[model samples]
Target: MDGTTVTRTPKKAALASFMGSAVEYYDFFVFGSAAALIFPTVFFPDAGNAALVMSFATFAFAYVARPFGAVILGHFGDRIGRQKVLMFTLVLMGAATFLIGCLPSYDAIGWVAPALLVLCRLLQGLSAAGEQAGASSLTLEHAPDDRRSFFTSWTLTGTQGGQILAALVFIPVVALPDDIKYSYGWRIPFWFSALVVVVAYFIRRSLHETPEFEEAKANNEIVKLPLGVLMRDHWKDVLRVICCAFIAAVSTVFGNLAIAYGVLVGLNESITLWLVVAANAVALFTQPMFGMLADRIGRKPVFIYGALSSAVLMPFYLLSMSQDNELLTFALAIATFSFGYAAANAVWPSFYGEMFSTRVRFSGMAIGTQLGFLMAGFAPSIVTGLGGVQEGGWVVTAGFTAVIALIAAISASTARETKDVPTAALGLTTRRAQRVEAATA
Candidate 1:
């Protein structure tokens, strides 16, 4: 608002963000699926249950690298432009994913197979650190203040689309006979990411920078060191986001850990994969609705409801899988994931982005979320190690999920409401009050 209205481009921004997120996460989730189902057998055959643990550990490696990625990618995103960082992340994720499909297993390459797999996964972690942060920052800056959550919701809804695609692709691959499933079928989904990346790259290339970033540029307010500014003035918001982001553990638990548990309880692998697909597919529709609801009401209430409800509902969902009833398992999966947790997932992009000025929005969101997501990246391995995957292990898993949710809900409760804050004065800058007054005037 600095004496001028910023022109917004919500639609193109939303589509580009959605498609890029879908493509990036499609590659990411394909790796998660493979880590859960394929890698233990192919890469670490001699280690028994330990093989599964090691495979999940490799999945965690990406998260370990995410904070570093966030620092690097977030710096450039805030410094250069959201568009350029997004392009780099897309290509990096695609290349790493495609290479994962081409890696030789232990039998073919000895210890080098797992070593190479770890290297590729580290690259994926770095790319993902920036993917959602850049996409959400781009979309939020392009959207009108009143409809920010509604449009930015597409960034996460794209994640749902990605999860759905990953599960759908894995369904057939899991159904293949043992030899083919272990060998060639699993690689197809990873290779498919190459096609997705190409399509998304062209679509994303058409979008331009946000008006807000341009306005910041015109004012000569772009920071030379975004991380330094963010840590100094916005440390509280960053901590809050990290705590609130713990809610992400709900997803990794539902998507990755539950799938493994479902198989142990006699459910077919295809059915387990379908359960994830069904929940995420439903979330694709429900998340946008949750985002709209946040716009109508508030982000805090919807987000808290999501965290608390998912905490309350997760035990039943996990326990249902251990029972003889497939219907209950599917129903609980949708209830916990699609209906309960979807609200938080849908709203965080806008909620978190609105917490910082344009000068450091990308770094603030990327660093905070990626740091918190370390727990998500390692949730399955942590839970499995804590005995959450044993015969009566739903207790430990549900308890762990509840603790994480509690921390997130409490953190979200402490944030100042940004729903009414204008796009021009979204962050905690020294001029924020003056800008807010001007924006409201």
Candidate 2:
């Protein structure tokens, strides 16, 4: 491709990536909302007081499948092409989500109800394991050297869009009478995922494979076993990404655990869902700005700021819910999530993907983030088990947030600054050597 085509491809890739991620996370977040509000009653009715924990555990099941999914999907992503693998993940997630909507309730089917729910959730997890990594890698590769972070930021911004869409769809469902809400209102959002999947599917299908991957393939640099190459060369980067990825738990705490906590603290269920809608709505705008900022200042500082700010602001946000002030709660929610945690969320696509060469970038990012995201996946169950959704659970939740944020910050601080590096020079030891190799080729 020529320079103009190359330049334009990034925009197309970014849009396709944004749509795919929106569809993927929309399906994922719908399940999260249902797990928090509906599944305890619908899927785990027999568990008594443990029903909520069990419901959240079903939410975690996808995370458990994620690492394995990362290995399987990431291999094909690197081996075949990012575009093809992404198409499969999008369809798989949509099918699994739609199946969950079709499942019988625990009342009608006994243990088979929760069993089927877990199975669908695992499929969701498997699809998700590759979605972000593939989207990020593809967009980053297509993006200009100077604008990679800004372009790739849209992938995460798409996630915020998904969360907003999910919460909006569920808000009315939560307001329905119990009989209707429990009977079928919950399934509408899950079924709505099918429509979105079709939309994103066509968008992604029209986009071409990334130029970086194409160039690498043309030069015979594609690896047969990407995992082996990743372990042999980029293991430390993978470790850093895993630690840096712990910040994702903050999202679970905000989106899932906080909803249950708010209800526990006397906020209405719809109000809690509105809070999610509000924070993520603001994030739709803020995350991209943070991405541009990362491109200018460097990824580490922006990511670390996001991490530490989340730790500092989380307690105040949680505390506000019990203060009987809706305005205060809303303000704190925006500050804690949109302005604080969003910075790290926005920058990680570039920060992590830039660590590996195009050859293993998919595998490295997928395996690393999925492994770390296990904490994010199980965070609701773990914190709730420790009383995060109980009367005085905010303290436990806040402390957990602080610990993960600090660890992510410390890990991020150790990473190399790639803000000034050329697109082709990234992952190589030095710019001069990269140029020499290019000339020799």
Candidate 3:
């Protein structure tokens, strides 16, 4: 009872989550861009038509390590705390990303180059698996009763900032001469993550634990085996969140495949990079606005609307890419990613975290989201193996986005709306109602 109010913690926790996620996702998204644009030549030179496939396969290796990281990190987060796990993940990611920059190319080390890249990528995945879940859970637990959705929305706003930094940094690197570009330009971005690592570590470390977790500790009700508790008590919620997390595949299609497709079709590369920058800039503004709207209205309407809108908008955007009209492409890109995608992106941290109690929130979110995002991790390679960026490839990719978006919409519909739920009783309706009545009186 000596702790700060929920209103104060939400803003502080959201800021902490925002900075931490910005750093982690900056490392993660930059690699996705590198995999699409540069890795084929540097790491997989011998594969001819299979070079892209090989590049994306290397990208997918990280997803393989994520679920395992989720289980291990999530256990400790629920047992010890959220802030500690986030700090651990940040260090792990920073080291892996920096090591990636040091990897020798195929010309220097032959096949060992790609293998080392895969090993580092797995470490990146392991770090990321815990980053979002822990951050989201921390934010959600600290948020005020009526505005949980709005506060937790900042966790995802951090991701848009990361994407923007990733694209902006790579924009220049893409313009470098092949020798310089391949040799040192790609490495610069990875190395720069050290600054983010240092700044974010200090910001996150200054924060206190969430009130919900603190309360759970006071009651001696913290679960020892959080994954087991999550499985036994909240499996349905986990499954639903997994389905919802699959919508993340759309990001790979847009960010990674769009870069590959634009280059293959003879469009200018800078334009492609700027497209991501522009869309994310719009999202930086749009996501928080939508989050506020979710607080006023409800999470489901905004979430479902976003999923359906993204599913519908993907075709227009992908079709516009075929026409080679930069204006049309930018317009459609902004519409699809910033407005449409931000709808779901802004809401999910609150929506998904509210589906479980604080006792198992981090474990539940990490395991479910890591498993679902594994599908997203491989989407670009799968699309490439089908065909590289033609209309047929676009059609297949669009269909994939629509199906997953629909699944996310349906999954969100299954959860109870927690807009009015108190932070101390997020997954418990009766206790929340009693708390609200007591507060109101």
Candidate ranking (TM-score, best to worst): 1, 2, 3
The parts of candidate 1 lying over 4 Å away from their true place are 1-6, 429-431
Compared with the true structure, the alpha-carbon lDDT of candidate 1 equals 0.92
Candidate whose TM-score is highest? 1
Maximum-lDDT candidate: 2
Q: lDDT for every model?
A: 0.92, 0.93, 0.87
Residue 241 error for model 2, in Å? Answer: 0.5
Residue 225 shift from truth in candidate 1, angstroms: 0.6
- Across 42-99, the per-residue lDDT of candidate 2 in tens digits comes to 9876654489999999999999999999999999999999999999999999999999
lDDT accuracy of residue 316 in candidate 1: 96
- The total number of steric clashes, by the backbone 3 Å criterion, in model 2 comes to 0
Candidate 3 on 1-441: residue-level lDDT in tens?
A: 455343347778999999999999999999999998889899987655588889999889889899999999999999999988999999999999999999999999999999999999999999999999999999887777777888888899998899899999999999999999999898999999998899999999989988778877877879879988888878998898889998888888889988888776667888899999999899988999999999999888999989899999998887787686889999999999999989999998888888888889999999999998988898888888877466457787788888889988888888788777666565554766577557754
Please give the TM-score that candidate 3 achieves against the real structure: 0.95
Residue 241's lDDT within candidate 3 is 87
Name the runs in model 2 displaced over 4 angstroms: 1-8, 47-49, 431-441
Better of 2 and 3 by lDDT: 2
Measure candidate 3: CA RMSD.
2.0
Clashing pairs in 1: none
